[model samples]
Target: MPSVRVVSLVPSLTEAVAVTAPGTLVGATDWCTHPADLDAVRVGGTKNPDVPAIVALAPDLVIANEEENRAPDIAALRAAGVDVLVTEVRGLDQAFRELERVLDACGAERRPGWLVAAEAAWRNLGAPSAGATRHAGRLRAAVPIWRRPWMVLGRDTFAGDLLARLGVDNAYAGHAERYPRVPVEELRAAGLDLVVLPDEPYRFTRDDGPEAFPETLPAALVSGRHLTWYGPSLAEAPEVLGAALRAVYR
Candidate 1:
């Protein structure tokens, strides 16, 4: 087989590829920040990657995510004969399984240690205590990704599934769209016990986001990476998310 040369379009996948097989990544998206010192060509953002620039890198494989990237770009690259590896991860287990697939395609001789550690960390975690949920029933939370038009996590999302594992239920998990846009007033009136905010897609800070929520509902600002990304972050996702969610209990 030809020696693999990779270009990662997704930030999380970039971390995965770089850390698993260092020196193999020749190109990555501008948003890819892990490894901090990653040596690769910048391929623009996830949604608007420079296809011509990517083609010039002569990467044997270009890795992308179904949700983070646009279909037109993936088609354009494939039309140019680039072997595009498009992965879809909707939960923690899928994240690990998909990582292995991507790594194996890139010539991994064995499973990387971080992958093992990440799985163990999630497996060993227990759900939040009953009090943390506060609701005698399952914890109900509104998880927002954007604020301008106001979008919230709805159905079949990695973030939603991750929260469920911690015993925190998503208020809009049954909505048809994976990310549904609802007005702020609607969210507040949705009978939500709390609102979980993540800092990505839009950087929802402690000052900026929590204030938007109605005082009747509580809010917790969590790391966007831990809530969204599916690479090495998976190792501590359970703990990081657990701590943040538990804080809202009291």
Candidate 2:
């Protein structure tokens, strides 16, 4: 019983809805590029969505996220009589709850199998030990999404939380800002044991980002979607991220 027509302003949510209930998505942002075979109309991007075009779709509902979509756009859509459900996902558990809520809103009664599988995968990781990262296997990590201004994961971020669950301590975990901007030289001198780079938000690659770090310091270049995306990708994220990190996080 999915909505007759729906639009997704966020890429992650787009993948979630598109996969969970395929034909419901009538329009999506240009950045929604998952499911390789998604057949939704393109309606601009996450930051600057085409409100008029979205309204033209006459969607019964529009899905969005607090951090990814602008407030003004949501308000405009609401004013136009479109039902917009905005999500706030700050952690792994929260992500699950939010995804379920979005699906329920879309008239989905049963949670998708992937959601259950993803939860089971992470739950199997168990709890972090009292002194898990004390010895040689201890890892002090810096995750940079964008390098132009040198922004690194800080404070209570989903990526940082996942890294911590994987036994990798975020170097800026105690920083006041969630995403702190630090100079490259400072990052290099921050005594980091490893730098976990993702191929998104800036697409850091082996040749492009690894060279920025010292030869002695190891860097794990992993998939940004797997590391940051919280959707159907979650089912494989634990294994995928673990394998990627293990490959280079030594």
User: For candidate 1, lDDT tens digit of each residue in 1-250?
Assistant: 2388999998998888788888888999889999899999999999999999999999999999999999999999999999999999888788888999988887763478888998888788765653345755678889999988999999999999888888888989999999999999998788877799999989999888889877777788888999999888889888898888778765
Clashing residue pairs in all predictions, respectively, total: 0, 0
In order of appearance, the predictions have TM-scores of: 0.95, 0.93
**With candidate 1 superimposed using the best TM-score fit, by how many Å does residue 201's alpha carbon deviate from the native?**
1.4
- Show pairs that collide, candidate 1: none
| Model 2 pairs in collision | none
Query: lDDT scores for all predictions?
Result: 0.87, 0.86
In model 2, state the lDDT of residue 166. 81
Candidate 1 lowest-lDDT run of ten: 127-136
Which tens-of-lDDT digit does each residue in 12-110 have in candidate 2?
888988888879889999999998899999999999999999999999999999988999999999999999999987789899999999988887644
Kindly provide the TM-score of model 2 when superposed on the true structure, using C-alpha atoms.
0.93
RMSD to native, candidate 1: 1.8
As a whole number from 0 to 100, the lDDT of residue 25 in candidate 1 is 89
Report the number of the highest-lDDT candidate: 1
